[model samples]
Target chain A: MFLQSDTPVQLVSSQSSSVLGEETIVLQYEAGMYYELNEMGGFIWSLLQASKGMTVGQIRQKLLDEFEVDAVVCQQELTQFLDDLLREKLIEATAPAP
Target chain B: GASPKKVYKTPRLKTLGSVK
Candidate 1:
């Protein structure tokens, strides 16, 4: 998975995301991919939108504070979810600055 | 530390399609 606790991530410029009601819609024009992120997905997307290049650990802390879940499970699921986004070319993850 | 018990739904992405 591309997401490490210290890995920083930001949304790709080719994509545009908007929130409608409870769901967030991401449109990737270059690839013509339209994604619908709901529930936890929406939350994560919003964070990335607000702050560019936030570390995975920071995002996870926000999730842990807002939601009730075991740390292991949260990490596992968050990693998988981020992997999917990476595979889909919606977000970009980078190593933290030294 | 028992707060209100809750379940977290794993974030999911549903791709509509690639633009033709």
Candidate 2:
């Protein structure tokens, strides 16, 4: 099901997203400003950018298809990564319904 | 701040603080 969060996290596609090595990246937009994301961040960001939108489960699925990691491991890692992105304001994730 | 290059072309990789 689609979610609706006031501060839902989504990438700014109009902005230039570039990969810099394995775990480094630069997102440039809104007046030459750049945001640097590390490797894990880049991976998550890459999926988001490619699909435009993916749920927590979808992200985990992608990880499963790409890497040889287990589902539980991927889920935990993806969930944590999503949480960090939200906490850091990197992404706008709607809070669970009260 | 010194000054912008007369002709801006090269990308300046300045160290960014922990904003992200």
Candidate with maximal TM-score = 1
Question: What is the Å distance of residue A36 in model 1 from its true position?
Answer: 0.9
Poorly placed runs, candidate 2 (over 4 Å):
A1-9, A12-16, A26-36, A94-98, B1-16
Alpha-carbon lDDT of model 2: 0.53
lDDT of all predictions, in order shown? 0.87, 0.53
The DockQ of each candidate is: 0.64, 0.02
Model 1: residues >4 Å from true position, as ranges? B1-7
Mind sharing the TM-score for model 2? 0.58
Docking class of 1: medium
After superposition on all CA atoms, what RMSD does each candidate show versus the true structure?
A: 2.3, 14.1
